[model samples]
Target: MTFAFPVVPRYSEIDQQGVVFFGHYLTWCDEAFTAFQASVGYPYPEMIADGVDIQIVHASLDYGSSVHWGDLVELVVENEKVGTTSLTSRVSVRRRSRSDEGWSDAVTVQLVHVCVDASAFTKVPVPPRLVEGLAAARA
Candidate 1:
């Protein structure tokens, strides 16, 4: 399943060259990941409270184009893979002119997170609820 998260870059996020700074895309990816989980009833804080948490093991971004400060960025997030102790999420950064009718892919971000015991920070199997939620949320 795919989840949609929208963001408009803050003026501060733009670089001196007038395009969005490369670093901000990662922030958006993280936000989208959290939002996606919350949408699935697995909010981060609540998960930690339950002694289950997810920790990022890797993140990668492939840039295809530049996005200006005002462009509309729609982050298309979905679970790419799920394993016994880890999961991967892919986020497509779709950017468009503020008044345009269509979007173009600006960046592709992939994040891999491992499930862990909150207290011990040791790897653990992905929770069944998360597995079921991701299965249902797949598009």
Candidate 2:
């Protein structure tokens, strides 16, 4: 499954040239990731409390266009891949004048996270529940 989050660039998030700062897109992706986890019933804090955690091992973003202040951004999040100890997620950033209209792709981001033992910070297999949740989301 794919999850979409609506984001609006704050005035401070805009650069001098009036476009959103590159770094802010990453922030939006992270926010979407968090929301995705919550929607899947295993938020970060809950995972940590269970002695399991996910750490970002890599993040990549490709820009296709610029987003300006007041432009509505739809951040789409979905599972790209899942491994024994890692999960890769794809986030597509799109812009639309209204929710009912067509969207234009602005950026695409890939985030890879490795499952780890919360205390030792060592690699570990993803929890069964999380695995099932992600699998269901991907379906």
Whole-model lDDT values for every prediction: 0.91, 0.89
User: How does model 1 fare in lDDT?
Assistant: 0.91
Residue-level error in angstroms, candidate 1, position 9: 0.3
- What is candidate 2's lDDT per residue for 57-108, written digit by digit as tens? 9999998988888788889999878899999999999986544367899999
Model 1 C-alpha lDDT per residue in residues 16-58, reported as the tens digit of each score? 9999999999999999999999888788888888889999999
CA RMSD per model (angstroms): 1.2, 1.8
TM-score (all chains, Cα) for each model: 0.95, 0.93
lDDT of 1 at 92: 96
